[model samples]
Target chain A: MVLDPPLPRPMIGRLVVIGLGLIGSSILRAADARRLAEVSVAYDAEPAVRARVAELGIADEVASSPAEAVKDADIIVLCVPVGAMGAVAQAIAPHVKPGAIVSDVGSVKGAVLNALRTHLPSGVHVVPAHPVAGTEYSGPDAGFATLFKNRWCIVTPPEGADAEAVQAVTALWTALGANVETMTAEHHDLVLAITSHVPHLIAYNIVGTAADLEKVTSSEVIKYSAGGFRDFTRIAASDPTMWRDVFLNNREAVIEVLGRFTEDLIALQRAIRWEQGETLFDLFTRTRAIRRSIIEIGQETAAPDFGRERG
Target chain B: MVLDPPLPRPMIGRLVVIGLGLIGSSILRAADARRLAEVSVAYDAEPAVRARVAELGIADEVASSPAEAVKDADIIVLCVPVGAMGAVAQAIAPHVKPGAIVSDVGSVKGAVLNALRTHLPSGVHVVPAHPVAGTEYSGPDAGFATLFKNRWCIVTPPEGADAEAVQAVTALWTALGANVETMTAEHHDLVLAITSHVPHLIAYNIVGTAADLEKVTSSEVIKYSAGGFRDFTRIAASDPTMWRDVFLNNREAVIEVLGRFTEDLIALQRAIRWEQGETLFDLFTRTRAIRRSIIEIGQETAAPDFGRERG
Candidate 1:
């Protein structure tokens, strides 16, 4: 394994990561790999997950409870599902030390920021962040130190939030090799609703629709999937509980963006029915430029089929 | 480069491929690499494409016209887009050798079979096939000899199509490392509408929807594409003319499948609006199983994010 270069100074004094799943375990691994924090601790509501994390040896300590995990942390990141953000914040609020920066890796920002502010004590700081990177796999073993490397991490700090705390959170992500951008919680929700949440919902919905087809057998769908359907299945295979919570928590933006998607799909359907070849061709050509832009920006691979191995 | 094992005997005495684009060029390359045909000839309406095919030296001879290409060939495969299939078939009809097998790689089989039957001479056997594989990129330079390796190629021969001709087409694809399955033309259209055509329509529609969003800037979508939107963009970037033809020729099945997709998406939207977590979770779980089946059948990769290179 390649070693990361040592940092000039540790970014955080004591770091606590709650919820030792994909994102949480990745933070612990990255912190240890880069020595981003002087001391790194971990906790998960599931006793089994904590035990497995201890076995992975990614954290300096795997705390048995949330209170113990945050008692000495200078920065605490809640990495649980969005629906559980409120309860996880409330559970650790009482023991969180003053001047600590509390952050999260939730997909939705507005609801998560509200949850953090509502439950946490006033003296502590809350700087919510979302690393827009992941694989279909989940759980502790599914993560690696470079999971966030070269990916975007949007930090949505509420207005009038502590500047120093925001800087510390931004520095942590930068040290982990992510490009950091700051925005309002509400704006972050709207942006992600288009870029991530609605896209995922569409993938899940199509796969579900394919599965329920009476004339088409599931075996046939599976067999002929490489034709294009398989790509959607990869994202549809992501953690169901996390995605469920994302939709429930980011309800407004998701519904609004989904409305746009439905409207566009209806127009495309009409074009098909009316045999409007020029209309279909124009939209198809326009969409290709966006893909080119994405590849040029390094957000996506230029390789075909995401560089999937060919036989 | 690794060499393909030589075939016991050439599958066809002479093979002519019309429309030297991605699928056509790939056929030429695979035929030469595996020695599937004793002599391979090529033709394209565009002079530039024919010149490129000659420069690549993939075909034994690059004929200037469809008539010249099929005049002496034993098996002729039309590789043009679905919209151009009838015209290409008619152009080559008078010159096609008697007792030769006329086949195609069009995505939709029923309409193509009809086009071939309507235009071609009675002595030549007509069989329509679709190799369910491709990259988003198009044209001669985008193809490789192994494009069909381990992928499924569905053969839809018209009723009472010559048995010997059907076997020859099957043998040619098998020699190029494809697993061949036989079905009726109508069934092939329906199966592909769900597994390939409709999925591409959804991908194209979503990308179009995202582009038209005033709330989310294109730059933001491009920069944060790693958050799931990029996958749809890959398919959305496919050749516009090719995809438009697919929806047009397969209109009946595509409209039926797309109707199902829209219905399911609306239900998902309602579930999100009502915060129906269990409903979302259940569908997500079911979709994951389809992905697993596809991987287990070797139609998809088991590696995370299609084994895209990491930083």
Candidate 2:
């Protein structure tokens, strides 16, 4: 079971990651660990986060401002929330290098692509990516170097975008141990709506419903959560502002998928009401195959209860 | 961090487990590991499962028939589905010894309590319990001795039941490494409906919805499931027959909780449709505290992603 260390791949001359949150700090840490870039810089709007990132020493240099962070960088990654993509692009536009590739790690690609295109300078390329990986915890302290390892990193380059820029972005994610996929922004949004966005919305919605129950005490819900409700709580515990922006920016796609979800749920509710055992059994049986498929593709763990330690 | 071994307590002279599924097999394994019962016997309706249990060697004896299983047992815990509880109870009623205790590990307490009380002999005491623990995988091979370790085992004794019989059932669960809680069958049903039943229904419902999407391919859903959909798939992958019986038996509580869930979801849908960022943020923030409480109380793991090994 002995394994060789990953060889350092010095792809970019200078890499700057703005917004030192979970994904941001993770990118910095992974870049340092893998030597994906020659020099790495970090910046965050919050002075406290920038100081914390500096203290953690994941980045070679902690920049004081968005403009300063991107001024001499070959690639600038905007890891801020989806809603803040435009403002961060605008803030860094004036100082960004002419040939620098401007990228983002937003969940919603369509809005983020439009935001980056409208704000960044003409010579600067825009490449938006959504890494299909995360945890419930957020912030710099919650991140680690292997967050993207063995995870999917989806790149949604705008139509008629530069190929070299796209390739560079893809290679960076690849060197950082991610399986990269490229798709249109619209397609990416629709796919993520069913796969990620709507799931998170429903999880948050269910947790809220459970918290406000009058017949059941909150303590009871918390105590017996191992049954199933605890899983939703984990997803619902994700960063609030980031998820808020995801729902806000991707409203159309989220609403469309959610409508379908409610329609299917209503049918299930009717089946439960009518005591249709066969219908429930059939749906329950079919869902197991999807879980198997995800595990087979190495997208999820096959361990029971996610390999959680039992006392 | 050295810990002492759990002290063995011989609580029951002869224990018979009638279903050999996940919960049933785990009970036998835990009983054997802790020495909670002097002799543990097992029987499953499915011949294949009974043979597998014998091969696993978790029980002292694998009985061939219902009569043979419970003929001389001091405590018989029926681990069959809620709908099958009565039939299993009735099958062994004529052969059961007088003054023996009959208990069950069914998920729905109220219906199971009713079924056991109606089918068991007059002198046999009925005490139904539901351990609020399990994995998505089921059957004999999917279970382990520590499945119930540090988990909650809720006991719902029939009204005016024998005091010694209730104590015996509670002591058995405690000796098997579970925290025992006593409550009325009605309250247990209500609590579990929110915590387990409805959560499972919605998980099954959402996975079905995602599978039926036209714009998003099933392969895409499986590839990008790590966002949040994968968590739901785990719950949805639970045993179909067991869950079908749970929804059918706990129809009232599940429907009531599901109604609240839909109402809350509609409000959330409206908020998203109207771009209410603050509304989403407020609820998302509040849900994080419940997750913290569940972890604090030891019902859930504090590790990120349930401590799944990262590559």
Candidate 3:
């Protein structure tokens, strides 16, 4: 069967994806696959990544410097770690062409926007974006063209910025197979703290706890991980440098949600000690609905558990 | 491209999958797909479950009683929760044909073996197994043939058990595409507690806490769950009955691991509160290695965070 091609978006005259890591590379792949841009260029700090892009032919051009990559590029996307955003912004500050829309794919929005906003030159539109998609893997080698298909790409427009630029970025993401949503930077940070940041931290924390256990327990953790803990291990296995930046950059939001999390955990501990089965069951049942919603929203594939995809 | 047809197994064999559910049904799918048995039967106390098995055509025959299911069966495997093992064992105690090999897919082995050893009649060999697999989904409809494929299936046979019976079960799982390992029931429980039970409890606690937050934060949990908490939610959404049974059956191991986890968590929490970057980064880096090991062991698929395998 001949497959229909992805829809075209003529509004995006030029598109450039910077960083070329998992998120950036995925965006490059998706945008290129969908033909969303007239010209798609990828830039990465690492020479190997640039060599990889050349090998895969994922983009029309590969640049080593942020200035050279963003030059004459209508849309520039920053996909570096949250902590690295400031330096990237500073380096590219003087080089950014007028009217060029600058956006990012950072997990933490408020801090990133704050960092980049202070570094940007006037007339260069800055929109902070958080694509609610990713895998446990990292680097250019671990990316695919279909990674963003049907995932969310949130665009947080700064106060009094160009509406047309925000819309254009949103349009570009939509054409790349992402559902676009606009949110306030503060609100985006708060929401992500609970959903993404806190969870990663907790996964990392628990895995650390397991690793630090007595030798008998540590070995047991690895051997019998199939039950549930192994899932956390997979998430916790994410890049340490990236995650450290995430925690340090998104400090307030992470700490706020974490404070609430520790309290709730202690309560559950109390309930378990008291053998309050009804409380446990009630919470378990309520949480089940959220999972159902995730499936219904088409964010998840139509497999109970994951057999439909894995098998 | 044409698919390769599987090699046929020896016929004239009878198989009974006791307590048909996610794992049991998957085993049936694998066995049936491979033509591993001439006749396969299933037993479940829930009439609805039995009817569903018939609806899915998972077995050649559906039996109302454990005794009926095991009658004339060469292999009888239990797939019930850990807590239900004793009752199931006693119910099938009087009806098992001589020389029939009995096995189980319970999570906590030590207690389950203890229960079965007390109830099963002599001459019926008990070979307890725990396939380090499963999804959050439950019931017969949730099963798939490839659930065990490329996953670990640990077999904990008692000392001096019949060699042929153990090998038969091992061969059966091997045919189903599982890598099998043998360990004592006591060791299996301890390992699972650190790897599966404690992590699950932590996920449930954090998700529950996030859910119980003041309205604003609660909504944020759902909206931004793309960050990290959503991973926890997936694990937290597992069947409450199975989890409850897990805690009760593996009380000693779970409690011991929980103690260690709490201590480590407290230390981390102190570090976070005191703004100790070195301490947090050190622990975080150490946990990353475990994640690498999981991938190295081939337990994980090569997908980025939420975008890897669809669940």
Which candidate leads in lDDT? 1
Give per-residue CA lDDT, model 3, range A113-211, as digits (tens): 999889998889998888887777789877777666667788899889798988888887877677788889888777777777778877888888777
- Whichever of 2 and 3 has more lDDT, that candidate is 2
Worst 10 residues of 1 chain A by lDDT: A1-10
Q: Name every residue pair that clashes in candidate 1.
A: none
Docking class of 1: medium
Ranking by DockQ: 1, 2, 3
Cα lDDT tens digits, model 2, B206-285, are 89999999999999999999888999999999999999999999999999999999999999889998998899999999
TM-score of chain B of 1: 0.98
lDDT at A135, model 3: 76
Candidate 2, residue A81: the lDDT equals 94
Model 1 regions lying over 4 Å from their true place: A1-4, B1-4
* Per-model C-alpha RMSD: 1.2, 1.7, 3.9
Tell me how far the alpha carbon of residue A308 in candidate 1 is from the true structure, in angstroms, after superposition. Answer: 0.5
- Model 3 residue A199 lDDT score: 82
Per-residue lDDT tens digits for candidate 2, residues A188-248, read: 9999999899999888888889899998999999999999999888888999999999999
In terms of lDDT, model 1 sits at 0.91
Identify the candidate with maximal TM-score: 1
Top candidate by DockQ? 1
**C-alpha lDDT of residue A164 in model 3:** 90
